[model samples]
Target: MLKLTDMTLHYGHSQILNGISMEARQGEVTCVMGTNGVGKTSLMKAISGTHPRSGGKLELNGEQLGVLPAHRMAWKGVAYVPQGREIFPLLTVRENLETGFSCLPVSEHFVPDEVFDLFPVLKQMQNRRGGDLSGGQQQQLAIARALITKPNLLLLDEPTEGIQPNIIQQIGEVIRHLRTTSRMAIVLVEQYFDFAYDLADRLVVLRRGEVMIKGTRDNLTRDQVLQAVSV
Candidate 1:
């Protein structure tokens, strides 16, 4: 559902992603794993238009995409749950979710029941301030807000980072359920090896902003991926 060819990104002048190329197909979890500062998060931002790529082609669902901003990308069916969760601390949980409605028609402004079904805690705390929630709850809120958009491509940057073990497992189960639906392509930027490995259909390892190793789960061994990311 998403493709990047020789993609590059820069913060002023220092390039973070160097000629990176990869594809994320519908109904598949394409896990991008690497050590810190390897541009895993930067790649996610580039794909989701939170940060525009400096060079190369970006195509989503077959159409070539230009350097559009984040909201525009959302309109194009891309949802990004960034590394920090980035929830509005001052806003209520419901209000935070309502923000996603900006990209949708007014008729579809309401949150889906399935969203609550996915994270029942959110439904219970709809009126709670975002900052008041625990880290794990906020993470769930971040993912839930993204799902509100009904995106074709979901860009998740480190959904497990700093989350509790139980919450991490819940997030994994949600990812698994999403994959089973064959609804959208998932590009997960993750550091937790076991969590990522268990859910990844395809693995794309990045080293210093370029793809170091990439293949299906059947083609790449666990030790190979672990070594590549560790190095």
Candidate 2:
């Protein structure tokens, strides 16, 4: 449901992404894997409108997008779960989720039961301050907050980083369940090879800010993908 053609981005005078092309389809996890300094997070920023693209085209559900800003993109159904899990430290869990209401209509202000269903812990700790939660709980809260926007395109950047193993498994289960039930296009920017590989329906490997290899899981084995990313 998301397509980026020849997508390019720059930082000051330096180019971080060059002629990159990728797509994410509904009910599928499109994992973008690469080593550090390969522009993975920059690509997410471009897609989520946190940073504007330098050139190329971005299309969502067949509609071409111009240089839109973050709020506009969020309103257009792009929910970004950033790498750092940027939850509000002082806000209560419920309040943190309510923050998503900014881009949504007034009638849709309430958090859905499915959100708490997907994250039962969020329901139990709705009144707790965001900073008081553990890292994993905060990560779950970040994803739940994004879901509060009712997005069609979910951009998740490194959800597994620094998370405990059990919580990582829970996050993976949530991602899989979302792909199965919501049918939203998910772009997972991840470096954890096993996690990405197990969950990815398609894989795109980036090197030096460009696509090095990309194909469906059926055509690419774990070893092949591992080799591509390890370089």
Best by lDDT: 2
lDDT per model, in order? 0.95, 0.96
RMSD of each: 0.8, 0.6
Candidate 1: tens digits of C-alpha lDDT, residues 1-67: 9989999999998999999989999999999999999999999999888888999999999999899
lDDT of 1 at 61: 97
lDDT of 2: 0.96
Off by over 4 Å in 1: none
CA displacement after TM-score superposition, residue 197 of candidate 1 (Å)? 0.5
Per-residue alpha-carbon lDDT of candidate 2 for residues 112-139, written as tens digits (9 for 90 to 100) = 9999999999999999999999999999
